[model samples]
Target: MEYDIVMEPPTPREFVHLRSAAGMRERSLDAARAGIGDECAAVTIRADGDLVGMGRIVGDGATVFQIVDIAVAPDHQGRGLGSRIMNELVSWLEANVPPSAFINLIASEPAFYEEFDFETCAPELVGMDLTLPTESESSHAQ
Candidate 1:
């Protein structure tokens, strides 16, 4: 099946839904609302008019950019939808972002992203992250 790749972020509702459907971490609607449409570049794929894949680049528009939210629906895995999404985002960055700008992403599958020239930052630099507790999490901790 041919998928339509659109050069735009998905709606907040669609973003939340597809993120979950793709087994990515769950994001609240409020977070989605605050995040969607803020990307330097974004790509969304639709199959038969239903959103099935998405990717985005975010950061300070000048010197830093991070690719995030790369997803493909479970049923759509094994297809090239994820690659197509990355192709669009990378192309946009290549055309627009400065050569000196830094582009990065946190990848679960390093092999996959290595195809796009992403290298591991281990042994030399460690990647760390922290997730702020949600209201329920905070209440439960007390």
Candidate 2:
């Protein structure tokens, strides 16, 4: 039987649900608001009208971009929805981004991303970040 998979650009609220359901990091409403904007290339899959998967390209349209928040709901996992999402995001990048643009992503399973030409910059380079302590935690530290 064929499934009804409708892919569309996701609204802000849908991103929140998709991210949480897919086990990605949570963002505050304001932070999420800040993340998605005119420059973003995003796609969401609706299975019979329910939002089941999503992916997005975030960063400067030309200089930098990151493939992020690729997620399929638990019930929808293993049906290749993640692959479909990546395909759409990569298509967007291919059509819109120039050669100088750098596309990056941090994947739990790097193999999945490798299918779309993603490579780890390890050894030659490393991914790093600085997480700020929450207010309560900082107060305790003080």
**Top model by TM-score, which number?**
1
Model 1 regions more than 4 Å off:
none
TM-score of each: 0.96, 0.86
Off by over 4 Å in 2: 1-9
Model 2 alpha-carbon miss at residue 120, Å:
1.9
lDDT of 2 by residue, 102-133 (tens): 88888799999999888889999787768788
Which pairs of residues collide in model 1? Answer: none
Give lDDT for model 2.
0.79
Q: Which whole-number lDDT from 0 to 100 does residue 42 have in model 2?
A: 78
Task: Please list the Cα RMSD from the true structure of every candidate, rounded to 1 decimal place.
Answer: 1.0, 2.2
Tens-place lDDT per residue, model 1, 79-133, is 8888888888888998999999988888899998998878998888767789999
